[model samples]
Target: MKAYSKLTREELQTLVHELKKEYSRYQSMEMSLDMSRGKPCKEQLDLSMGLMDSLNSDADMCCEDGTDCRNYGVLGGIDEAKVLLSDMMENNPANIIIYGNSSLNVMYDSISRSMTHGVMGNTPWCRLDKVKWLCPVPGYDRHFGITEYFGIEMINVPMTPTGPDMDIVERLVREDESIKGIWCVPKYSNPQGYSYNDETVRRFARLRPAAKDFRIYWDNAYGIHHLYDKNQDYLIEILAECKRAGNPDLVYKFASTSKITFPGSGIAALATSSNNLDDIRNQMKHQTIGYDKVNQLRHVRFFGDIHGMVEHMRKHAEIIRPKFEIVEEIFSKNLGGLGIGGWTKPNGGYFISFETMEGCAKAVVDKCKKAGVKLTGAGATYPYGKDPKDSNIRVAPTYPPIDDLKTAAQLFTLCVKLVSAEKLLAERTGEAPEKAEAQA
Candidate 1:
């Protein structure tokens, strides 16, 4: 239980030796476990099987407006779908547009459209000399991937418990004309599970950006995803707050049932001001006749309404909350008060972010891989796959079964100890890891 920092060189070396033997035993087991992606476990996926059953040949295909869901005409999604998602997003139905399965796709297309057609008639971002984006550290990697793919220069904004540093955010967007947008996971954020507080949301809503096209990409992906029914984190819904602040078009809010019903197969949506929705529709008419309306109908029939969706998500919560607890329990028991690392105990969201000593994340992940356990690649939580401190490692516990997660987590903590000990031993002896290994 003693902190690694207080350990003598001999003590640390001895610990490393014992950890290596344990690591070797794990390697000998030839285990191939992956804790990399936030995929729902089979049991969790099974909870939504009723969604498939929600549709059948005998079922009525006519939507509320009498539009046959089997046909393609409604570009803005059916009235029923809009109402359902709008209710879930806490926005007006008129402000919502349901898309294909993935919200990430909607996000990518939003950026791509701005690059080519510009936002609400501004000059295309492709015409700009420099395009920059604000990326919160330890954020969703795919969000950064989209901006990075478009050759957008990303500036890292440190994340606190509440949200991104607003003073820096306010100052940067006010002074920097080229800074176009920021990626936010406001409710139960991707890796750390931190939610934005009220003041942070207000400051974000009130910002007067130098760039007319500046926006906050408020991806409320986990709006209703809670591990504890009573201890949930609340996010001040951005679209409404922005409207109240007189900056109705300052943010684009996105949500999906990907985590709720099925990932990549569930309905996605974007909620914004009517002006933004009109602009999108103008261009969207040329994109396609419509997205999968039958799928939209399927979702509507499955959930029946927002209340039904909420009840279904509670089923998901029941199945996965224990998995989150298992990982937290293991991490707390093995690593607590060790001073070698620290990790988040998120209230919701698919991942738990772990911060190892500076320069140790990659090494720990690498060691875990060699022992037949896979973690999310180190530095993945940052833009351009680069972590300035090389410290944050995301632990995805939801995908694996309970027993497998236990083994994987134990291996992960072992890797942490081995790597931390090596770093310390190297510092004290001024020797390379290989040399330190030989000595240990």
Candidate 2:
């Protein structure tokens, strides 16, 4: 119950010895648990088994517009699918383009297209001398990975509870012509589960970017993923807000049914201004005849409308809610008021972001791994796998069962305490003057 930082060197040493004994017993169990990826558990995935039965060999293959889904003609998507996904994406069907199963793939291709050809007749990014993107810290690693792969220079913008710092964002974008894009999770953001409030969204829409081709890569991946029905967070629709700000082409929004139905077999979509969609279509036409309309049709038939999708997400919430609570409960019981670490209690989303004492994240993660618990690498939440403070660690509790997650969370807290004690003892004995100065 005592704060680890207040403990004397002798007390810390005694505590570490006691924890080591507890950890030794845990090691004897030889558990092989993984809390690395934000994946749906098998029970949650089972909720979408009905999708397989939605289409069959004997089923009709014609779309709502009478285009044969079995053929390759609908470049954007089938009519019914557009309607379904439009509702899911919170945009007009006319402004939406349904892609294949992966939103990440759509995101990658979008950047690739911009790099090779350019956006709306701008110079191709490949031809430019410098291209940059603003990335929010403690964001989705995959989002950072995509931008990093394109060799785009990424600048870290600090994320507040409401959203990323808007003052810095506004200033940078207005002054820097090479800052072409920003990556945003917008609603129920990855790792932190923080959503952009209306004011933040408005500020985002009103940004005066120096680059004419600037865009916001808005990945609304967890827009509808709420853990509590009553205590839910809302995010303003960026595309609509941009239009209201007289910047209709300032943002591109992405969504997918990957979490709703199947991870790799669901439908993905992009919503943007008509002009941006047109520009994308020009490049899309050359890429292929069309994306998989069959899977789109399957998704449409399975979730008839936005309401149906919402109802289904409630089922996923039921399955993962307990797992999330278990982790929170363990953290609260073990690490509360410890002055060693802190973690977010997200309303919805797949991850809990833990902030360890400065420079202690890698040690905590390494301690966890040595005890047979696999976590997302400590620095993964930042751009280039480098958490400058080495203090943020992402905890994904959704993929494992509740019992397993409880154990994992317990192990995680033990690591936090152990590492914190070591850090505190080192500071107390003047063994780490540089770290002490860094803290000061």
Candidate 3:
């Protein structure tokens, strides 16, 4: 149980030998377990089975306003859907536009629009000499991918427990005219479930960017996703805060029921200022007659209201909370005080971010993959898939069942120890860890 660094050469070698034997046994099992993405498990997905039944041939296809959902022409969304998502997104019904299934899709479209047409009559980003984005380190990889796909230069901002370093964010946006936007997950953020504190939210609302088109892409993916009923993280409604700060057009907030109901069929939404919505409509008008109104109506009918959605999420939390707790328990029991690595115990969200010894993360992940377990690639959390420290690994626990998660988590910790011991042994003896271990 001693810190690996404090162990003698012989002791470290012995530990590595034992760990290798255990790892070999795992490999012989030839099991294939994946923890590479934060996806809702079958049990969690099962909770929303009634959604399909919410709409049937026997049900009326007309919305509350008497518009038949079967036809097109409601470019924004049905009124009932707007109200449902508005309550969930914490915006006025008039300000929210419900889109098709995925919030990620909405975000991608937003970025694409900004690039081709521009935000609210601003210069199109494609015409700009340089387009830059501020991305918080250890942030969402898909968010990074979108910016990278558009050839936008991404700058990393360090993340704190409260939020991204506002001192840095404020200075960068104020001085750089080409920095168009920053990606944020604000509540129960991905990888690390750190929520933005009040001061951070205020500073973000008050930011006076050099670029008139600068926008905050607020992806509140887990706004109400909490593991604990009594203890939960609350986020300041960014759209309202922006309006109060006299920068109503500064942020575009997004959300969806992808996790709540069905990942493949849930409704997505964007809540923003009228100016931004108007600009988006100009492009959306040509895009299609409208998004699937039938799907929107289905979501509205299924959830019934915001209260119903809250109750539905409670059911989701019941299924997911234990998976999170078990991972925390396994990590603490195996890796605590080892001085080798550490991990986050998120109260909500689907992931737990682990920070390994610098330069050891990639090796640990590779070891796990070889032993029939898969983890998110090392350095995948950062922009451009490069982690300068090469230290962080995101552990996704939501997809697998409880038993499989337990095994995967234990294997993950075992890899951490095996790699940490190898790293220390290499540093002390100036011999390759494999060579030293063979000599042991």
Spell out the clash pairs found in candidate 3: none
lDDT of 1 by residue, 1-440 (tens): 69998999999799889989998998998989999999988888888888898889998999877899888699999999999999999999989998999999999999999999999999999999999999988899999999999999999999999999999999999999999999999988989999999999999999999999998999999998998888999877888889899999999999999988889699999999999999889888999788888888988988899999889878888988999898889888999999999989888888899999999999999999998888889999999999999999999988888889899989998899999988898887899976897799
Candidate 2 Cα outliers beyond 4 Å, as residue runs: 432-440
Give the per-residue lDDT digits (tens) of candidate 3, residues 217-336. Answer: 999999889999999988888888998999999999999988888889889999999999999899999997888898898888888999999999999999999999999999999999
Of the pair 1 and 2, which is ahead by lDDT?
Answer: 1
Candidate 3 positional error at 26, Å = 1.2
lDDT of 1 at 130: 99
C-alpha RMSD between model 1 and the true structure: 0.9
TM per prediction = 0.99, 0.97, 0.98
Q: Write the per-residue lDDT of candidate 2 for residues 1-440, one digit (tens) a residue.
A: 78887777788768777776787777787888999999998998899999999999999878766888988788998889889988887899999998989999999999999999999999999999999999999899999999999999999999999999999999999999999999999888889989999999999999999999999999999989999999999888888889989999999999998888999798899999999999999999998899998888888888888889999999999999998888888899998888888889899989899999999999888878888899999999999999999999999999988778888888899888877877786778777733532332
Specify the poorest-scoring 10-residue window by lDDT in model 3.
431-440
**C-alpha RMSD by candidate, in order:** 0.9, 2.7, 1.0
What is residue 432's positional error in candidate 2, in angstroms? 5.8
Worst 10 residues of 2 by lDDT: 431-440
